[model samples]
Target: MISKTTIDQVYETARLEEVIGDFVQLKKSGSNFKGLSPFSDERTPSFMVSPVKQIWKDFSSGKGGNVVAFLMEHEHFTYPEAIRYLAKKYNIEIEETEQSDEQKEQANERESMYLVSEYARKYFSEILWESEPGKAIGLTYFKERGFTDDTIRKFGLGYGLDQWDAFTQTALDKGYQLEFLEKTGLTIVKEQTTGEPRKFDRFKGRVLFPIHSMSGRVLGFGGRILTNDKKAAKYLNSPESEIYHKSKVLYGIYFAKQAIAKEDNCYLVEGYTDVIQMYQRGVENVVASSGTALTPEQIRLINRLTKNITVLFDGDAAGLRASLRGIDLILEQGMNVKVCTFPEGEDPDSFSKNNSYEDLVLYLDENAKDFIQFKTSLLAQEAANDPIKRADTVRDIVNSISKIPDRIKKEIYIQECAKIMEISEEVLYDTLAQIDKKGFAEASKKIKQEQKAFEVVKNDQVVEKVDVQYELERKIIEMLLLYGNLKQEFEDLVLKENEEGELVLEPEKIEAKVYEKVYLDLQEDEIELTNTQFRTIYYKLIEDLNEREEFTVNTFIANLNQEMVSEVSSILMEEERYVLHDWERKEIYPKEKGQGIAQLVGETILTLRCNLIKTRIQKLQKGTEGNNGDNSEVLEEIVNYLQLNKLLNAKLNRVLS
Candidate 1:
């Protein structure tokens, strides 16, 4: 356990923007910082960081909390681990209490895998620097590639020994479990016929690159073999596992995310070496596809930072053609795509190794072509002197243009493409329309096929039957979180029976704190929230409000467990997301919720009571049919309930049934 004092100090010292900006590209938005949500695939910026409150919220994913919570959600770190990360970031010393045996035994599976992967990074790094063959082979290979000592250490480049079981034995000896070792692909385990199981190092005799998640946790490793052996593969990557999914993981992303956002662009390359080399040369906003086909997940990762992508291609025609498939995916994401080809004889790795940073950047600026131009030029060369190939290339380019979500961008590309191919504008537009029509028909068919499956899934997995009740209960919690201690004049509205018992609106204002008003109103109705968690939070807030002069959202959140924290955050942030105060800037003035806080709070409680009354009325109706005694009182009770329900509907501004 970390000391409470240490945790407090870390939280106090950690700035929300500083912590999250390390992984996300946060830009100034009025009083807060905004960026594309790291938690979801979004084109518009919705992730918000509030330095004043020391909390961040993803309007897209509806995840929000203090700085520590952000790490816990994004890095998948345990609570203590998030605190430790913050402490390390701010250079604070941490004092931890010893873990109990039961606590150690209860360590989670995902966290255990993280522990093993992190341990392996350190272990491999140690071997690369201190061991004989590692120093001579691994360290030597990195240095020979023109990587400086700082560069090697910064990226955590390491080496696996040639010995069959070097890494596996070391990890096992260190008390790391064999199950995790095998799962992480750090150890290759095979069953022997009669003896103990045989195991070996997976990356033996290879230099290593530790691929990191956005929060800098070790997810997996990429190893490059240095031998000239004809039988061996040149590079091997960690197989898919819990923490590592290569399609979603960009090499050097943890290091380059800030730069990518700052530069307003991300440079996509094919190899880890290319990213590392170029980044070291001061072009910091660079990432590699890691030789895999580029995936939309990878594109979304970059989209969180910026919408501009420049793909760097080597001069080789065959590899370049193979890589072109990825650019359409980038375009489909609505990102600006620019392609840069190095000199015919050189790749980014080789070129950056020799050229000055200034020269390399200048070359890129001068040579980079828009994807449409690059595709047209490259394909036009291939389609030379063949009418069928020319027609096919035109269709292929049109297909890519159709993939673009922005119709204006598609038309712009179409115009540029027609000029390049010497074709009329009408022909290109006709081709695009055909492709879109075909795509829509296929998509509609797929949606129809899956509509039944979609119906079974609940909204946020909460049942629809009582969703409105849940909303009202959750609204009470939101009111407490946002304005619990603030005192304001709450309008008390009533309908008067003037002589004939006809309704007349009468209004008065009563000054009270928000929580006091909510508590008293619920107390008067003798009603409680139906949901267990909401009820717990409701009582906890009431208790805290009574016990203290003021209630702070952060302090209240800190007292809850992880589950309640997420629930409470969702309620608070979802309210903020729906808030229309900021929409006025766009000429969309909306009625502010704060304008009628009293009505809002009062109506929520009234609605809950109204639901209960309706339930009771149904019971009375059923009882009247079954009762063998006088049913006058039961029918009278039902009539009175109906009248009370009418008054509640009137108070709620709903039309009476």
Candidate 2:
């Protein structure tokens, strides 16, 4: 465990822009840096990083948080890993309080897997650099691939020994459990005829490539065989595990993310070496599909950085007819895809090796073909003088175009396709509209089917409906975070029962801090938030404010667990999202909470109380149905609740009751 002092030092030293800038190209926009969202596809810059507030928000994805929170979301890193990453980046020394045996035993499943995977990455990197067999095989293979020593180290390339149990033995000796080793697919466990099971290295004898999450934590490894044994598979990847899901990960996203964001273009390739060689040659914005058929999740990963993807293929690798079979997914994601083919008899690795960096880059720029033209040219060659095949090829091209989400892009592609295939533009548009209508109908049908599948079952007794005040509850915490320490004087609008037993609002001057008033109001009414997470935050806020003379968002967040931090961030940023749009710029006076801090806090609590009374009145009404006794008392109670609800709503300036 890292010491609290060390974590705090790292947090204070790590600038939000400086940290996020490594993975995103940020241009100064007023007081903040704006870039294309690292979490979604877009042409305009919607991702904002504010050094003043020490937070970032991706308007597209609706994810906003502080530095550590960004890392956790972006990299799928555990809390400790995120802290350590920041500590390393900012050059802060980390001090640890070592965990005991009991603490180790109590560690969660995800943390254990991360620990084992990180250990394996270090172990493999060590073997590649130090061990003789590793040098003769893994290091030699990497060098021969034209990767420099620094590049290999930067990417964390490594070697897994040929020995059957070398890694397995080292891990167990280091106090790592055999179960985790097996779960990470680092150790292959085999059952014997009699006695304990035998274990061996899964990546034994293969050169290793550690696949990283966007924030640069090792999630899994991909190993390539040095020997082309006919009976064995050429490449063996880590099997599915809790820590790594291949579909959600790109091979070199962590390395290429910033480049992709800066260049506003992503180069898609088929293998790890393709990305490595291109990156080595200065085309840093490239990632591989890792030989798996590209899943929607994979396309979406690339989609986050840029909408433009230039897929590079060696001459023979272009089974253009077959390649187009998978490209519909990219179009569906609204990516502007272009195809670039290398010289005949050459892959990206060999081509880059054979040509100078200048020539290689110039050739890619000149040869890149928009998808419509690329598909038309390739299929036209195969369709040579055959009208039927030509018609079918045009349909295929139009089909891909129809999947495009941008209407303007679709229209442009329609024009290009019509020009290339000599088909009428009207016909293409008609076909596109038909496809879109059918798609909408199918989607609607699916939603209906899903809705039908959702059924609620209850006991014979009445089901007590939970009438929640989430918005008001959220407002209460928001005010606590924003203005809890600020003092305010206001006319007390507390409703009271006079001697005649009539409810009336008695306005009187009362002065108190926001937190004090909120605490007293809730305590007086004995009201608590019904939502579990909000309730927890509410209590923590009161305790902290009570102990200190001041309240700040940073102070409030520091005490929360990761889950609670995310919850608070969501509530705080939900309003910030609107503010970020500059509604005030449009001749609109956006309601500033600071203007009516006292009123906001009181109204929030009053609204919650009013809602609770409404719920009770509803229950009483349910009770009254079939009740033959004491109708006058129930009527009076309902009227009183209604009057309270009306008074609360009036205080909020709400016109609707």
lDDT tens per residue, model 2, 182-216? 99899989999999999999999999999887777
- In order, the Cα lDDT scores of the candidates are 0.86, 0.83
Per-prediction TM-score:
0.89, 0.83
Regions of candidate 2 where Cα sits further than 4 Å from its true position: 15-76, 437-471, 493-507, 510-512, 520-536, 546-550, 576-590, 605-657
- Choose the strongest candidate by TM-score: 1
Model 1, 341-375: lDDT tens per residue? 98888999999999999999999899999999999
Best model per lDDT = 1
* Residue pairs with clashing backbones, model 1: none
- Scored against the true structure, residue 64 in model 1 reaches a CA lDDT of 80
